[model samples]
Target: MGAAVAAQAKQGGAEVLWCPEGRSTETRKRAIAAGFSEVSDIAEMARRCDVIMAICPPANAESVAGLVSAEGFRGIYVDANAVSPATMASIKAFAFRDADLLVDGSVVGSPPSTSKTTRLYLSGSGEAVAVVAGLFSGTAVDARILNGGIGKASALKLSYSSYQKASRVLAAVAHGLARDWGVQDELIDIAGGRSTSYLAEPTYIPKVAARAWRWAPEMREAAAAVGELGFPDELAEATAAVMERWAEAKDQSLGISEALELLRTDGPQTAPGPSAE
Candidate 1:
């Protein structure tokens, strides 16, 4: 979302600067080209920019926030990662020392570009909302401010992802079972007749599949957070476990690209033939 926000901020005549994670090609290149100064210091970026948006994974956001805090950086820290509400609260506590904390939870329907569409759900202190509300308005991006503190926005994001994740898991499980029964195509057709048409090769499926492989660690964090809230995250935990299995089975690395390629090229052990009457 740094790219989306930076591109939008540029359109709005806001000068942009960026501090990227050390290991990310996606963030490093995207931030520089969008006119953000490629500064290595998180403190410097936080000290200079009006807002510091943390778009890392939920598992990583706190470390990013800690880095900013360690630098004694001062600015609005907007965390737009996909995390549980409880985790957001912990980050909020960490942010209270020097920065104006805004806990943001964003869901991207597509890539972060002029050609792509995305959504940002903003929350946290009301004052933080007031300061950054105009940044998202009247642009190619769609950002809505939500009520509550810290975790509400993150909760919303996790819930949204959970639904999508659940669908993919169901698809995987059902597909596996159908192949075992020798009725994969017929089962898929029958399910399509009853379920939403979008389920038939969902547009989000590939992205989901790709992401599935690498989400185990993050999902573990999410599961822990969810469990802390007294909610049973069996589905999320199971999804993560299955993703690990898929990754190991393919002999590919834990990344979206590898997983996508593996799923595309790999064959099922149990092939579906004609259905038994």
Candidate 2:
């Protein structure tokens, strides 16, 4: 997603810079293909760019911000990770430590591309949010500046992802259960009769399986937020546990039934293919 954002910026005629230090060779190749000017390190990027965005896993949000802060990257810092509002507040504390403006941002939908674009929800200093929004103007990234302060964007991201992802998992489990009773087709037909139903899209189960590793952590983050708000977190926690059953499916392709089998048994039935994540 970080690469997708940079590629979208470059497409929008913005001069984008990326630091390949500590990143994978595949990451470097993707950045190179996006036409991002490479710098030696984060310090170099901090010295050169007006804005720095971190679009990583939810677990790494704060550590990544600490790295940027240590380098004194006082430019507009956009933390676009999927974290809870409280986690975002902790990040805000350190991010503001260096007197740097922190813009809470979140990415919803898939990675932006010509075929499909994604939404970037932004919050924090109104001016800073506008500046970050302008970075992706007219690009594949739909930068939407919200009328809120730091953490609202992340809150919205978590709320949406929690339900959307859990529903996909629920669909897989429901279908698998129905199949055991010789009623899988009836289940699909029931869902297909609805205007919008995830159960009608069993083909997406394999894709969900491929992304479960990243998603399980996200659900836990959502559970944290729910617990913080004094609500029952069993739904999120249960979804995460189910996703963990398919943790070995990270970036691995498998058939719909095979993906569901992973949810039922500890050992997954593999259909060898290339990684997707």
Best by lDDT: 2
Alpha-carbon error at 72 in model 1, in Å?
A: 1.8
Give the clashing residue pairs of candidate 2, or none. Answer: none
How far does residue 145 in candidate 2 sit from its true spot (Å)? 0.9
Q: What is candidate 1's lDDT per residue for 108-220, written digit by digit as tens?
A: 56645667757777776677866666676667767777876566677777767777777776566556545655889997788777645444444544455555656777777
Q: After superposition, how far is residue 135 of candidate 1 from its true place, in Å?
A: 1.1
lDDT (Cα, 0-100) at 153 in candidate 2: 86
lDDT of 2 by residue, 1-277 (tens): 8899888888887899988778999998998887889999989989998888989988888899888888987798988999987887788775664323788899999899989989999888877888888888898899998765877888899988887887776566555556666888998888888796565688999999999999999988867765665555777788799999987899998998888888875365564432211
Candidate whose TM-score is highest: 2
C-alpha lDDT (0 to 100) for residue 3 of candidate 2? 90
All candidates' TM-scores?
0.65, 0.70
The residue pairs in collision within model 1 are none
